[model samples]
Target: MWELQEVPGRSKILIHTANYSADVQGCIGIGSNLAPGGWWVTQSRKAMQQLRELLPPEFDLTITHYVPEYP
Candidate 1:
């Protein structure tokens, strides 16, 4: 697992996958799309696989918070 460094008051944070957010614990979950109501993410395994192919073994990740405006 890739460990996040320099996060305040946090350690061992990783980028992982799960079918539902309920299955995740204090870690980043990677998914391709949101489920019908946006409660959970879908295609997590596929997304992870794609990330594995695209990302280098070691690289820096930037996390950004984005909220879509829905009319």
Candidate 2:
């Protein structure tokens, strides 16, 4: 998940996705693979749960939008 600070109330906006785009409006997608149409995420819940456990309650999350290449 990603977050942006410096806003008015300093609220922590989450960047997570549900099963379909219709379920979440303009929200970021999370999963191991893109769905068939490439508009949805395949394993969003699993990905989110894993992320949630790893993150601390209050902390800064920097989003670089970087994708690592594998050998």
Candidate 3:
């Protein structure tokens, strides 16, 4: 249920974790941004882990910090 996006003006990485709500918010729009329906969902923690491991090297992505106090 996690998501990530590389906004044009952003310099750091962004990672969305399913551990919280809104993890998939606005995520469906990514399909229109990337390709013709490439967005998919992951239900397993292992799958999420793989994504976490593999995504950074593929792009200049930044991991957004989730401050415990905020949520």
lDDT of each: 0.84, 0.68, 0.42
Over the stretch 1-71, how does candidate 1's per-residue lDDT look in tens digits?
A: 46678888988888888777776788888899989976899999899999999988899878888999979
User: Could you give candidate 3's per-residue lDDT for residues 1-71 as a string of tens digits?
Assistant: 33335466544333443432355443321121222444344443554566666666455545475756633
What is candidate 2's lDDT per residue for 1-71, written digit by digit as tens?
56556655646555775777776565466676677856666888798888778877667655566887969
Error of 2 at 11 (Å): 7.2
Provide the TM-score for each candidate, comma-separated: 0.82, 0.53, 0.28
The C-alpha stretches of model 1 lying farther than 4 A from their native spots are none
* Per-residue lDDT value at 19 in model 2: 72
Look at candidate 3 and tell me the lDDT of residue 47.
Answer: 49
Ranking under TM-score, best-scoring first?
A: 1, 2, 3
Which portions of model 2 show Cα errors greater than 4 Å?
Answer: 1-12, 64-71
Question: For model 3, which pairs clash?
Answer: 13-61, 13-62, 14-62
Report the Cα RMSD per candidate.
1.6, 5.0, 12.7
Each prediction's number of clashing residue pairs: 0, 0, 3
Off by over 4 Å in 3: 1-15, 19-23, 28-42, 57-71
Name the lDDT of candidate 3.
Answer: 0.42
